[model samples]
Target: MKFNKLPLEEPVLKGVQDLGFLYPTPIQEQAIPSVLNHRDLLGLAETGTGKTAAFLIPILQFITNSPNNKVSGLVLVPTRELAQQVYQDAQALNKYCGLKIVSIYGGVGKFPQTKQLKSGVDLIIGCPGRILDHMRDKTLQIKDLKYLVLDEADTMCDMGFLPDVNKIISETPTSKQTLLFSATMPEPIRKLTKNILKDPVTIQLGNLTSAATVAHTAFPVPSGLKKDLLLHLLDKTPTGKVVIFTRTKYKAKQLARDLSKEDYKVTSLQGNLSQSQRTNAMNGFRKGKYDLLVATDIAAHGIDVSEVTHVINFDFPGTTDDYTHRVGRTGRAKQSGQAFSLITPEDKQLFNQTKKKLDIEIPLESFKDFDYGIFNPSTFNDPIKRNSQTQSGETKPKKPPHFYRKSAGNKYRKDVNGYRRSRSSSSGEKMKTHTSSNNYKRRVRPKSKSKV
Candidate 1:
């Protein structure tokens, strides 16, 4: 369906025409009408599927029709980059209509955003934390809010911002039209919708399991050799506008730095960077200043870079949903792309689960010149266990260690080297340390529940 065929105002249609968008995307084709009808909407769409425009267009139309000077519309996003992108899209669509819109996010100073709020914005696009701050300061009031949108709700849940989101939602009037959009809906998001939306129209554009446009491949490699294999793949594969995902912020930064030294136009986009730095990295990546963006899952939601040729998983994703979001970064706008992951024995379970759940074939590829005989597990912080061959030729990892170790009344003692050692019982009991690699777990504490 075309934009003109939908019941859009003349100014909104003119803006759409100016952008040269002849036909509405699949999500847009269905969601715009439901949004226009003023019904609560729950839309499931993949990344880069024009879902942003789908809701933005109808919201702009509603605001244009009413022309309320108060903050009538509010869009809550998960990241600063997404807030900026949505603000830009709102500006482009509201050009002829001339609606006062402002984007508020953390990372930068609040003085500018305060001035904009003081000037009286018709629509507000912001993250939950900063918006809650504004509400507390009495600078921004949304009691008269007519439209409320929760974009990238799953990302907010992942970032531990759902509590703040709930607080913000409690402030808004229940009479307002609510719209929730996500690429994939997890249980938390579903629970959120149950509380926020009332009998909403559900529009799902595609399968929620995986991106059909992406070709999946897994390279069996030791965790120690992942970086080398990534480098090898980068040298061998043909790519344009690639995004490499790491599991942790430190890894993303270090990998980006290491790749930069090798003359690769690469930049990191993890949470460690300031707002300006994040914006610069994204802008540079979009403008072709950088060919590669090494990021955590923060970039997985609402980053609208076009023509992303490949998504390389330097580390295995934590869950199947994570795999979906990471791979969804590529193959956008109906373009076919490739996703490659370097897997170790530790990642085998999750990889197999993802493959089975997505019901997709991921061929195991071996580089012709790379030697697979050099199996090194000591390079990792904890050694990766390998399957032992038995008499019947069945392979199984050795029995796992006991969970709790027997400790004496003096629990821990510091050795001369300053390392803490667990004391054994006075009965001369041997303390068996659980050296199983899977026993080691890393917990990343959220800096702030309110921060994006």
Candidate 2:
């Protein structure tokens, strides 16, 4: 369906057309009407299904009809990569509508965001952490916020942002149109909606386990041999731009360095990167300055680069749903792509469970000359378990969510420093929500819901 016919304002319609959006994806076709109708929405969609545009089009329409030029619509995302992505899409779609959109997040200068707040912006897209920072400083004000959107709600909840998100919602007026979109409606997201939304219209895009366009595969290589397998596949596979998904920020950087060392164009995205550095990475990646991008789940949804030929999972993700989302980076928009994982013995169970969750058989691909026995538990260096007794005293990761110390030190202790388990890492336990970062929910009528 064309976006113009979805109860959008003339200017918003013009803007959508100007962006060359002639058709709507399955999620957009269902969610847009609900949003334009001002109904609270709960939606689920796969990545690269034009989800951002789904919500942004209606937001632009509502705002265009009553342009506040201030904080009228607010989009809350989980990471900086998503913040930029949502803001960039909103701006792109509303370029002809004269709406000011600002992306606010930390790990960079705050002055520019503060300045934008002062000057006034029609829509604001941001991560919960940085937005709270601005709010605390009294530099960013949203007294006039009308629409409150929680994109990737499951992720926010997983990142332990439920408390922080509650505080942010408290800051916004209760009499607001709330939209919560998640790939999976976890307990936290369900409860969050119960507190915030008023008779929300729920749209389930069916029980689709995985993206049909992506062909999944798991190569049962030993842990130590992951890099060699990745290199071999990259050299032989017919790939467009490729994305190498890792478990941690350190691993992402290390992989990028290793690949770059082999003269392969590469970059990485992680929380450790400053805003400018991240911008550089995304810009370079999108512009084809890099053939492979090593990233954590942070960029999984936000990245919408089309025709990604392959998705390489160097490490086993924590959840089966995450496995779906990670591999979803490719084979989008009806294009076929491959998802290959370098699984070790420890991941054998996970690999089995993941296939069950995806409800598809993942044919194993064996390496001709690669030896997996060395990278297996017997020969691979065993990781050490650190004694981080908390103040009752429990241990937690001192850094990123990926850093974790498994009790079975023999398997995970190789580089225990990064995962020297800390309490903070516990709070930031990764959630497995995967949806297109570009999605937006709009409505024209309220719909009924079914009980779970």
Candidate 3:
């Protein structure tokens, strides 16, 4: 149905038309009605499916149509980036409505936020931590709160902000209408809905998996050669805006630097970066100033860059849910995109699990020029296959291996008697092997006359 057909105020409808949104997305079409009817709602939809607009439109409508406009609406998000994004969406949708909206998030100075809060905003979009800080400082009050939205509920749980979320919810009025949205409904989010929502209308659009428009491909390479494979793939693959996901902030920064050195327009979005740096990186990437954005899982959710052409997982995510969010960065808004992952032998278990859980076949691809034999799964210490000691019923920790100094040629020669000798130590100084139950270290004798 068209957005104008929905029960929305004239100002809200005008704002919708100003944004050129003619028809409602499936989630918006289904969930907006329940939300407008002043009932609690639980919406399950994947990224890039217009979930933000679904809640924002109705929230804005209620605020515009309300007789008393206190600080009635509050939206709790998981990340600073998401807070800003939703704030912008709210601004755009509240154009004709002229409702006062303020975005409160950490990573920036609080003076501006305090000023805005004191000035009396109609709605607030903020992260849980910053919102709690404001609540503690008594700068923002929500006792009379009417509409409360918990966007990306699963992400907040994953990021360990559930306690803060619950605290914030407890401070709000119990009679308020609550709306909870998530891509996947894990046990924590399920319990959350039961407690926060009151007979909510549940609207689930798709399966709890990655987007169907994304074509998944895995390139098996050695751990040490992941960077090489990434460079090669970037050179060969045609992409507009590419997002590369790494597991650590350090990896994101280092990879972004490496890509910059290779003359690729790149930036990094991770937790370690300063607030301004993070904002600049995200804004630059979104505006096409940078072709590649290397980020941690912080950017996995609530980032609404609809034109992303590709997503590369430099480090395979730790869980299937993380994998879904990483790949979901691309294939947004029904646009087809490619998701490439550099899979090491160590990721074999997670790789298998992801395919099985997502119920999709991710084709193993090999580059014609890159070598894939550098990492041998058989030789690699597979955690799945423990040592023989475990089979022998030995529970004690294994002894540390002895380390000897390298020879002049950096090679050790094995004699016929099973003894190892350095080529430079021809003076009959044979390398001795020692086994000890406790942690042990053997010092090599220096060439000097004094013993070390």
Candidate 4:
């Protein structure tokens, strides 16, 4: 459906045209009307499904019609990055409407936010923690808040921000219209919907599986050879604004550093960095300053870069939902995208589990020239198995036997005998031996000495 046909105000329609949005996505088509009718809505769609516009457009229309200078709409997100992105979109859509919009979040100063709040904003886009802070200090007031949107509600639950979210919701009037949107509807989110939304309209766009427009593929290689395979794939694929998802912040940083060393314009977004650093990385990637962005799941929340042609999973995601969110970054707004995952032998179980849960077959691809060294799953049982049968049968040092240790106060007792001795409570005597051992040494090692 075309956005122009929707019951949007003239100013909002002009803003939509100015932003070059002629057609409405499926979620937007279904959600804009319900929002315009002031009905509670539960929008189930992944990131980049035009869910932002689905809610933002109607919100702009409402605020433009009412012309309220006070805060009427409140959007609670999980992260500061998402808050910033949503605020930017709100500003763009409300350009012709001339509504005041302010984004609030932690990890930065709150004085400016308080000043903006005092100046009176029509809408607030902020994270849960910072929004609660403003509520506590009475810097931001939402007593008469008309519209409440919990964008990425499932993410807020995952981040353990539901308590803060509930508190913020409590501050708002119960008569307010609530809109909860998420990529997946888990049990907690469902319960939240029951408690908050009053007879809301539920809109489910796609399944929990990957997007239909995205091509899912995997390359099974050893952990050590993943970087080589990624480089090969990057060299071969015709990609623009590729995003690589890593499991850890350290890995994202290191991967970005390594990619940068190879002369690829790469940056990273992770929790460890400062807010300004994260903002810079996101802005740089959006502005084409970086061709590739190596990030953790934080980027999977609300990153809305339109030119993302590909999403590469440098490491397998922790869950099927995360995989969906990561891949959802691409194939957005009806645009086709490619999702590639670098799989190691250890990740096979997780990959298979995710595939089974999503009920989607991810094709396995291998490069013709790429060399996948001897990676045997059976060799995992015996580390020396591969080296022991080399062409030049050279004897290598066997790995040390594993030992268990228990800490007694500051000192550690190494149980080389493989059996822990129990003391009789009544007599304070050692119990009978459960196993026989040749070495029975009771050495008192200093607690200050480091164990190797």
Candidate 5:
């Protein structure tokens, strides 16, 4: 259905046309009417299925009709990146309607956010943690809120934001209309809906398991050779835009660094970076400044990059739902895309479960000329180590070996000297070293007062 076919106001129709959206996505087509009727909605759709517009269009229409200058609509997301994305989408949708929208999230100055709240906004798009911070400071008032949306409800549950979400919901009036949109409805998300939504209409677009447009392929290699396989695939496989996923932030950063050193336009999105750095990385990727983005699952949420031809999973996600979310980045907007995952013996069970549960037939591919040697768990610690040797029997220059040791409940890295140094891990905390090389022999350091 088209935007004009719906009961949207003239201003909304103008905005829709301005954005060049002639047809509505399946989710948007079904969700807009339910939201227009003021019914609670539980929308099940994948990331690239226009879920953001599904809720934003209806909410913009509602706000445009009501003409509220105070905060009338609230959208709670799991990550700051997602919050910014939703806020930008809302602004675009509200262009003709002239609704005041503000996004709030941690890792930045709360003063500016407070100033925006004090100036008064009609809609708020934010994460739960920053929203709670504003609530505590009495800078944000939602008692007059009429529409509440939990975008990516499943992700919120995964991030342990349900309790904070409930508290924020309580701050709003019970008569408010609630809309929950998720790719998959796990038990926790279902429970959240039961407690929050009232007589909601469920709109399920496709099978909640995986995206239909993505072609799934897995390459099983020894863990030690996974990075080599990744490099081989990336070098040979032609793609327009690509996003790589890693299990940890450290791995994402390290992988991106290694790829950049190889002269690839690559950047990383992870938790360790400051808010500005994250924004720069994301904006750079969106603006086509970077061809590849390596990111962890949590940090990659709310990323909507068009023309992403490939999604490479360097490390298998913990759950099938996460795999779906990662691969959903591609094959968007009726475009076909490929998903390649570097699978190893450790991910055997996960690979089997993903195939069985998601009903996806992932054909295994191998590099005919590449060596799949015996798996060494230590060599898998860093991607640079994997590329040390080439197919032509050439070796790259190796860096100094680092050792990890636990001392007095604190983890530190031991260098060539008999001193311990601390480094940041995926969690952004100074912890034990994560990299080890087979060339270096393990040495135990004696107790010493010197710290390096």
Candidate 6:
């Protein structure tokens, strides 16, 4: 229930207290002890359920008790963002312990990381690619690894790094403690577990691949008007940290730019930016430099900021798994949170799948007369039509066409010859034929008769 009763070291307890962690979430409550006891664990918990702390806390305590340079613990994450996050947490919590932690991920030089390895670190927190690089060069050794953690396992598999992960694991001692974590357990993950983890303790929270704490809602609107709806909601919402999830890095940048132009202090995270740009954005967000954070899903991993009151899904994520991770940004650490999705009519089916996956109904809320200000549904029915439909099964009468049109049955009025002629009721003018030439002939015949 509490951090103190979990058999953690006194130093870790002090750090946890300083960090204001009182009660453990479901995953933490179950997984911490297993990790502390040095048992292999396969934990299935949604993001933001304290999965990081579940593994990190114990590893820190263990390394604090005994430390070495042969990489005592190895954490394999799926993305650069997550690797940095784990490294930061380890560095922070293990500050007093004097345990060295190195973060190795792509987008930078191998020389620096190799140089860091030469200096000796007790732990290696890295992405699959960089870790594989070290293994290929025989520069890093994990044979002495006592703790091996696969964080966000499903993501790793999705990114097509399972072979790399397996190779990295093979380099380590088979007797090492393996901790595998995933948000969803697809069949591949299950098979990977069966082959890799040995008689592991299993812990799961919420429905599979879904966050139970997050309240989900979708506002059906046109894609073009999504920005307007986002602004309106931000203006109307209560003050707290907010994360806006965009589908692409370009969208993330554009969203941040537009929001900043609107005079709202905001930050952005994406793949294209350099490491410094990412660091600045993350630090700004964590230090309250900006209350609004716009990011792509890749940048969103390992962002464990607190007091995030809302998560706005500016683009409906591609899959239910992604939706779970996006919403998990909020409702963290037992705090209440709300996630709103701006869905187009095309995304309705995806929204419904999310609902079914999450096993909950999230009703759409309307601000009457506001039309939510920006979102216009493709199938938007008139309020009058809605009222009539409620009374009868049919929609209300259709108004006359806005453009002028003659009656449908008049071929003379609609065909090619009708353009120069007048109708029977149209000013009651007589019609003239283009081929008639009798006027000049009659005048000539009268002249001829006078001459005779």
What overall lDDT, based on C-alpha atoms, would model 6 receive against the true structure? 0.76
lDDT of each: 0.80, 0.73, 0.80, 0.80, 0.80, 0.76
By TM-score, the candidates rank as: 3, 1, 5, 4, 2, 6
For candidate 5, list the clashing residue pairs, or say none. Answer: none
Q: Which 10 consecutive positions of candidate 6 have the poorest summed lDDT?
A: 414-423
Give RMSD (Å) of candidate 2 vs. truth: 13.8
Kindly report which residue stretches of model 6 are placed more than 4 angstroms away from their true locations once superposed. Answer: 371-452
TM-score to true structure, per model: 0.83, 0.80, 0.83, 0.82, 0.83, 0.80
- Indicate the residue-level lDDT of 437 in model 3: 15
Candidate 1 residues lying further than 4 Å off, grouped into runs, are 299-302, 375-452
Q: Evaluate residue 276 in candidate 6 and report its C-alpha lDDT on the 0 to 100 scale.
A: 84
The better-scoring model by TM-score among 3 and 6 is 3
User: How would you encode candidate 5's per-residue C-alpha lDDT over 1-452 as one tens digit per residue?
Assistant: 67789888898888889999999988888988999999999998888888899889888888888876799999999999999898898888888988889999999999999998988799899999989998999998899999999998999998999899989998999999999999988899988888988999999887886677888777765554556677777666667778999999887988888777666789999999999999999999999899889999999996888778789999988898899889988888877788888877568678779887888787665555555443322222222224367889887644434443332212343222111122222221121221222322332223446788
The residue-by-residue lDDT of candidate 4 on 1-452, one tens digit each, is 78878888789999999999899988989999988888999998877788998889998888878866789999999888889889999899887998889999989999999999999899999998888888899888899899999998988988899999988888889899999999887799989999999999999976856679888877766666677778777766667788899999888988888777666888998889898988999999999898888989975575788788789999999888789889988988778888888877567679879988888877666665666444422222122123254567777545434344442221334333211122123322222211212222222222454689
Clashes of each: 0, 31, 0, 0, 0, 0
Off by over 4 Å in 4: 376-452
lDDT of 6 at 101: 87
Output the worst ten-in-a-row residue range by lDDT, candidate 1.
414-423
Per-residue lDDT for 1-452 in model 6, tens only?
78888898788888777777898877888988888888999998888788888898988898889876669999999988889888887777775677888999988899999999988888889999999998788788888889999999988887788999999988888888999999888778999999989999998776665466677666665544567667666665564778999999987998898887776779999988998889889889988888889999878886888677779899999987788788888888777778887776557678778777767776554333334322333232212122245555677554422222242222222211101111123322222211211211111111223565
